[model samples]
Target: MKSPILRLDTMKFTYISLLILVSPILFLSCKGKFNFSKQKAENEKIVVQYGEHFLTDRDLKLILPKDYTKEDSVNWVKTYIEEWVKKKAIVDKAEENIDELTLKEIENKIVEYRQDLLINAYNNYLIEKNIKDSVTDEELFQYYEKHKDSFPLVKEVVQFRAITVDKSEENQAERLFNSSKDEDFDEVMKMVLQAGNAYHDKDSIWYSPEYIAAQFPELNQNDQLSQLISRRKVKISDENTVTLIKILNLKPKGSTAPYEFVKPTIKNLLLNKRKLNLLSELQNQLYKEAINKNEIKINEN
Candidate 1:
């Protein structure tokens, strides 16, 4: 039976999934405008808005439609225009105060933005052209075999109680060990596993070795904790307080993952590799052209 919290969590997940599924379709219906092409000046273009300071488009659709009504769009446009005007006013004021170097810096920024936009446009085109739905199960399996160690299967974690005490508690611990001899070893272990005043269950008493090693670095070894205590017994303040540990349970690490376990992940990795390969080929072709045409120049200075 699922807990109420779990059920609510599941419902929350379902709600999110439904929202994700319907969001794009709803956005498309309300605001049909989308920008697949990179921003570039065309010979023929529709002028949505033009002002003394700035220009914007009616095609600049709102990303957050759920928060605003249709009347809000009008207000948004007005606010946007006002903001642009304010920004331009500040820029114009700054321009009047700028030196030759500042103007040169601004020109350099414009060139960088142009180059960035062009690269993004080219990458988008290459992605559309080269990437395809050709990755099969066999392909994924082969890829996984090649890169099996990249993603190891989630290992099963073991829980065990460990108590470290000084030499002063030796007598108390010896007495307890002797008294608990007749009792079931497991039961004795469960009983002794107490934090503060309350006793935690056997399952809850201990933690995985990995977790323990991280939290309590004093435990000494990665593989075994028992070796650390036996070597050197430190002094304890109270003789009555016994250092006791319990090995609640052992959960061995899981084996290597099968091909089916990582098929989807391997498929994605293979697709990325193909995309990179395509990009490299295009880059080489462009490099050759630049060299042939003497478009690229090298300056030692």
Candidate 2:
């Protein structure tokens, strides 16, 4: 979790220097190419600056995750620095060009936004500190069973092996896959890999019918993927490659989604529900206390 900003000195570059450092890279963009190791300076590296406001590398570190690679962090710094520059430039222009009353409106809006942000942050902090975030397996299962209708499958999902090989090896590949006596998917995959260039052989994972259709357009020749089952072995040929697909299982729409696949989703929903309940309880308790102390007054005419 080391900070990507190795040299704090380089962040002290002038506004013009930053432009010079970032602009030429637009002329040549490539993955793993963003590097700031060379931009060493005795002064701190200033990420973005307008007048006296300076956003440095350490400031950017607050928002960027600690696990980002040097390449990714450098790119993120460039993007954020650009946004910072544009925002400051526009806001400074608005303050200079806009009238006093309109400026006061903008000031009030900023205050409102800041207040909302603070409240939301504090709420989130309290939830993380006090709430039991983990949802047990039993809890998730019970929730899913009770609300199975809410998690109905909307898309046709299937477990299949898609083996794609060169056009010339189509017949041989299909013969091997169909003729395999092995029960294990790995064994089948090994057989396919010997002849095919690439494969999708995860028998455990279910994929959407749309995904299968896209991967092997031949699947859409007659009946759709929903109608196909594991016993079906399909051969699809294109101009360059041949695809051999075996549909192991098919689960049509309206069926309950697999519990394992939606565990994280269910956990989040339960956590949010808990937070809402706690918030309601807090509000109610405060209101009752306020009424007893004569702090709350209602004059309904």
Candidate 3:
């Protein structure tokens, strides 16, 4: 689940999304010089002012995601300003109701949280700057061998090519399919494509039987597809259309996925593991170096 702060921001952006849909022409007209950060703090103009607490144009612009168009810039700033106003209102009311002692405690907690946030952000920045990103094929293979059980193929999947067409085109498709040979598979596909409403040529991409069924909505389940996958070509004719399914490749359930198929997943796992290890290593080294230089002190109880 997203944090409340993040969810609020997302909801705030949704208004902008809807507004963009409502009137693209008007939204475009509303667009102006939206680079809020270009202005100095002294020159910064207020977009939302809630009595004592105010939000600046720079603040809204910084929070907006990159690649925002001129219309997006205007809408997001307006959305964020409205959100900030609501938040400030609640905060002001809460402050009035709370006792000074409780408010002081809350302020202390916020200070601590702010410090921790900055420190952690800087730590991540340093770790990212120093960490190695690319994992080698050798590294992946070694990790996979050691942790094979951790990566299980839970679902039945297959690789296949299929074509679907209206019943009228079924005879011509079947004739073209039969006339084409394996070596001329590409050319055969081109011919098959024209005769079908939808088609997928044989490719390296893998798909679950459930996914294939979901994609077509003609096949019942994975088992039905699995049974037909080994055959050269299976044609099913219905009231509306005829569908042809051909198995390019198949990976049975419980079978370990190929290294290439899982390379990306393995790479991300390795990267995270390396990052954690590096953090531990750097923290220990820094602590020891700090003690040696008398930069950090501990008072005995």
Q: Which candidate is the best by lDDT?
A: 2
Worst 10 residues of 2 by lDDT: 7-16
For model 3, residues 1-301, the per-residue Cα lDDT tens digits are 4433343355555544544544333223224544432344785655443455655545665677666654565566566656666676788799999999999999999999999898678767866787556678899999888877676677756677777766776676666655546655555466556764678764577777777778766566445654575564567677997778876667766788756667789998888887778767777998999989999877898
lDDT of candidate 1 at residue 254, scale 0 to 100: 63
Give the poorly placed runs of model 2, Cα more than 4 Å off.
1-112, 126-133, 165-176, 179-187, 194-196, 214-232, 238-242, 278-301
TM-score of each: 0.45, 0.51, 0.59
Q: After aligning candidate 1 to the native by TM-score, how far in Å is the CA of 227 from where it should be?
A: 32
- Per-residue lDDT for 1-301 in model 1, tens only? 4433333334444433433343232222324554433353453233222222323232334321445544454455445544544675677678789998988999899999999899878877877766767687777877777877776557534444444334554455444443535354344444455322122234443344556546444455443354423332222133444444444444434644555545777777878887878878988999999999999999989
Name the best candidate (by TM-score). Answer: 3
The alpha-carbon lDDT assigned to residue 120 of candidate 2 equals 78
**Whole-model lDDT values for every prediction:** 0.51, 0.69, 0.66
Error of 2 at 190 (Å): 2.5
